[model samples]
Target chain A: MTPKRKQKLFVILGLVSLAAIAVGLTLYALRSNINLFFSPVQIAAGEAPIERQIRAGGMVKEGTVARDPDSLDVAFTVTDYVDDLEVRYSGILPDLFREGQGVVVVGQLQPDGWLKADQVLARHDENYMPPEVAQALEEAGYSPADYQAKAAEVGERLGAEAVGESGN
Target chain B: MWSFIHKLGSPRWFYAISARLMPWFWVAAALLIAVGSVWGLAFAPADYQQGNSFRIIYVHVPAAFLAQSVFVGMAVAGLVFMVWKIKVADMAAAMMAPLGAAMTFIALFSGAVWGVPTWGTWWMWDARLTSMLILLFLYLGVIALRGAFASRDSGSRAASVLAMVGVINIPIIKYSVDWWYTLHQPASFSVTSRPTMPLEMWAPLLIMVLGFYCFFIAVTLMRTRSEILRRESNKRWVRDLAVEGR
Candidate 1:
């Protein structure tokens, strides 16, 4: 290759590398802000600021949803199995919002640590299957319930261990 | 190898070869998309949760895949043009910009429509969505940069540099859902993992993706041939071909 052509190639490579590095640094600096929502664990650990609008996401705890018969008000406990955050909203939830499914709520964090949600969005997982296949899986006792139970059991054990360590 | 590359870089060679290849691509695209659309919309069963709205995946996924793939292809073409001084590569890249932008718009629009039913909102400034939006802007920027300069040589070089630099966004878009807590889900298809979707559902999606790729190639070839003719109109071969048409 001619020296001039080789030099032009090197310049192009250098420019692309410089641009990549710049973008990588920018994304790294904004990593926390780039996340769509904080997890229930992060909120529980007080990483989420109070009195400011923010988003928190986690699985909807099974059997924790309460709905008002006369109003659109609803309350649910969002849990990551390690921690739980209570979310109160007064609007219609998405069609996919249900027990054992992932959800994200946007609202202000009250002084008491509850999320007073103005918006609730359901987070779909990567799994896609036909209705009949899903029904078959449920009938075969291969349901998300088993996974939820295992996660809850692990959470309970971790809590118990923490308590024991505190007693010492 | 050098001679082969030089031959490949020739506009006349590409114009001749693509004329023969274009018909095959057009036919394949038409047949695959026709069969895939029918199978996806009519034959595939509704999702357990999403129901009928899930059928939009047949369109949305293929557009999104092409959107990203076209950007990468454009960047690669830009690199070839810059390194080898291939006018054919630059011409192809120029033709690809609008199509890439169109694909990105289609993906964003279809995704927003799908989001209304499933996520309860039409838009959110999530990582994946935001990065894809940036990709659309990058495509526009490349197109605009190409035409802004007075000299065609400088314009092509400027556009090539921009395309190469903007390609950093492609990986960010692909990995956004996995890296951050976005409302967008991760991809169902993976090279190494077991398929999340059943054959009845994913088969049509695969066909649609292949159809979209063929369509991209066919359209780019058609457009690039016109670009060659317009740019090389003063050359003897082009004038001869023009006269031969008469």
Candidate 2:
């Protein structure tokens, strides 16, 4: 109701609208350039942005990795468990890189849908629980014995799978 | 309508009310965080893939969420201050900037640390990482701008404008994982979508998020009360209260 307040309100309204316009313009201008990584399914659906530097990410399909006999060049297929993409790279892979692991590749996508990767980065699984997080779970109907048992169960399964793998 | 507005806008009135409210928020914060932390760190199953390191999400994601949310809250408060000449709102915004900046740093540090075991690196020039970094700078910029101006009124106004402008980055940071190729993973939490994770994996995270919010509220209330005392020190009531303390 006061004139002084009225003046300040007008200034705020004017500037906020100005800021909104700026954001709208930025979003509109950057529309085509905002290519986040494409998933395997997206790529298979031909939704990947073509001919530009882009990223494709998915799990490395099991047993789909092959290495050259005498070179550093390697080939692998990345899949979303539905569609698959073949990635070829000559660089030394990250230490964590392996078959059946999640990985993201940055490179060019060909018209034929092959990805020539210039770099490969393994997607790390989030795995750490701090003291507080551990404490909270304790109050949430948690039992240490049961948790350890479940972990052991998973370990046993993993060990069995590993043995089966080595036998092959 | 105006009576309620006038009462809330007064520093003295806010100080009294916030004093009453702060205790509950503090208690809730401590309890929620205590529970969230224990659950997230111990009882929650190790990630099928990342194992123990994923537990950092308990702090990392909540801090990141706070970093972005604090910035938005500051901007809204700044807007209220600028438009309505509400000193209380500006005081709240000023108190929040440092906390916001700290949360941004925590998010960045945790993200970097989380990167090593998974991405095999400590830092990347990736989009999500980069935009989040910019969010840090935006917080710092508002803080610095507020301090830069000689006149308090002008300084507050400048900070308000800067906060409004900088808020544009919040959405950019949110969508960066989806909008650009980044080493950072996409959000496990979404408002319009279901969590990609199972209930057990995400329950602790939800608690952490809520705990972080409570922590922010409690801290902001405490600090804003301090600011009120500082700014209104010359006022009769403030001086009377101070003398009464002795």
Which candidate's TM-score is highest?
A: 1
- For every model in order, the fraction of real contacts preserved is 0.85, 0.35
RMSD of 2: 10.2
Best by lDDT: 1
Write down the C-alpha DockQ for each prediction: 0.77, 0.20
Off by over 4 Å in 2: A1-11, A36-63, A68-73, A78-86, A90-102, A107-118, A124-168, B1-5
Best candidate according to DockQ: 1
lDDT, each prediction: 0.89, 0.81
Clashes (N, CA, C under 3 Å) per candidate: 0, 32
What TM-score does prediction 2 earn?
0.77
Could you give candidate 1's per-residue lDDT for residues B146-215 as a string of tens digits? Answer: 9999999999999999999999999899889877778898787755677578899999999999999999
